[model samples]
Target: MFKKLFLLILLLGLFNHTSHAQKRIGIYSLSTISSKSGHLFGLDSDYNGLFRAIPAYCVDYFSNNADFITIDRKNFQLIENEREIQKSESFMDGYVVGQGKSEGVDLICQSVFDVDTYSLIIKILDVKAEKVLCSSDKKMDKNLFGIKDLKQQVTGMLLEISSKCFENEIPVVRVLETKGKKARKVLIAAGSNLRLRSGYKIEIYELVNEKIGNKTISRKNTISSGEILKVEDENFSVLEIYEGNEKLLELLNNNTPLFCKPTTN
Candidate 1:
C-alpha cells in the first residue's frame, strides 16, 4: 500500500512539472478596435463592454500557453449589417491620408481618411518597424481605406493599449532603432519622417510606380520595386532606385520634407 502511494505521488509530481515547463511565447488580443476611422473613436460609451472583454482575454491568454483574446464575432456581425447603411448615407468614404514626393522636390500633401466598418478587418501594423505587416478586409464593405505607415502606427497602438500582453512593457521591438551599417537607398512612405541619410533607419512605403493624379510620382528614373530601407545618415543623398527596368536616383535635396498620404476610404 505504501509503495502504491509513493508511485502515485511521483506521477502527480511529474505531471505538475510538465505543466509548469510550458511557457507562453505571446499574447494576442482581437478587440473591437474603435478608431477615428470608424467614427466610433471618441463619441460613444461603446467601449465599456469591449474593455471588459479585453482584460478577461488578456488574463486568460497570459495564463494559458496557446490562448488569445479576440474581438467578439458578434460585434463584427453588427458592423457588417450596418455597412450598406453607411454607404447609402455616403458616410463610409474616409481616408487615412498623407503625401510624398521624389527626393528633392517641394511638392507635398496632407493626411487623408478611410471609412471603417464593423468588419473583421485584420491590420497587422508595427509602429516600431513603421510598416504594415497585415491588412486584410474580410468583407466587401465600402468602408475601409488603406493606411500609409500602417506598421509603425500599429506598433505605437499596441504599445499604447496592449502593453499588458508582453513582459517588456515596451510596445514594440524597433528594428530600425537597433540596426546599424548594412543597407542602401532608403524608401520613405507617404507621411513618414525622412530627415535621415547615409547609413540606416527603418523605411516604410509601398515601392511601386503609383501615379497620384497626372504626376508621375514614382521613382521616375526606373527604380525596381523593392522594400524601402531606412535612411542611414544626415548628408543629402543622391539615392538610386531600381524597380524592374527603371533605375533612377533622387538627390535628398532639401526641396521637400518627407510625407505620406492617406486612403480615400
Candidate 2:
C-alpha cells in the first residue's frame, strides 16, 4: 500500500509539469497613428462647420519620414519618411537578403472627424537579418476640438506630426491575479468526458483557500459559446461549471470551483 501511494504521487507531479508547457499566447499591437489616413489638413467654417484632415498618403509618407517635411528642389519636396529612410539604409548596406522589399507587421489607424478614410503602411527591417518584422494601418482621433474649447485642426496636424516621430509603441505586459468571487462563469471540459450548454450555471469554491484568499466572486451567464463554455475543474476532482451573461461571460475554462447551487445562488 505504501509503495503504491508513493508511485501515484510521482506520476501526478509529472503530469502537472507537462500540462503547463502547452499553453499558447501571442497577441500584439503594431501601430496606432493616423499614418494611414488620406485626409490631411482640415477646414474651419460656421454653418455646417468643416475642415478636411491631412491626406492619407501625406500622413503615411510623413510618418515614414519620421515626421519631417522639408522643401525639395524647384518643383517637389522631400518627405523624410520613416520607411523610406529604412529602405535607403538597407540598399546602401549591401546585406539585404529578401527577394524584394522586406516585411514587417501591417496595421491600420483612423481619426474622429473624417467620414472618408485613409490607408497607410510601414515595414521595419531588422538590422542584422535585414528582414521586415511587422507592419500596420494607423488612425488618428480628432476628439479634442469636439469637446473642449480648443482647435481641432491644429490638434489633428500636431497629432500627425507626432505620429511621424515615433517608430512603434513600446510593448508592455500586465499580469492579473484572480479569485473566485470575481469569476463570472466556469467551464468544465475534459475532452470526451465532460460537456455543457450555454445557460448552464454552477457555484465556484476555492480548492486552495490559503493561496487564493477570499476574493472568489460569482456571476450568472445569460449567454454561452457552446463547447468553450464548459470548464474543466481539475482541482475539484470532478467536472462542473457556472453560467454568465454573454457580455460578461467570455471564454470561461480551467479549474473553476463549482459549488452546489443551494450553497451559492
Scored by TM-score, the top model is 1
Tens-place lDDT per residue, model 2, 1-265, is 9999999999999877775443211111122123234322222212113322223323333333322321111111111123223233234223222211232212212222323342233333333344444433333233555422122223223233332334221111110222443333332322111122223233332223332465763333222221124333421222222333332223223423322211111
The local distance difference test score of each candidate is 0.29, 0.28
For model 1, residues 22-127, the per-residue Cα lDDT tens digits are 4322222233333443332221234334333333333332333222222222222223334333232113211100111112111111111222443333333332
Model 1 stretches with alpha carbons more than 4 Å out: 1-75, 82-146, 164-167, 171-265
TM-score of every candidate: 0.22, 0.20
- RMSD value for candidate 2: 20.4
* lDDT accuracy of residue 227 in candidate 1: 35
> How much is the lDDT of residue 129 in candidate 1?
34
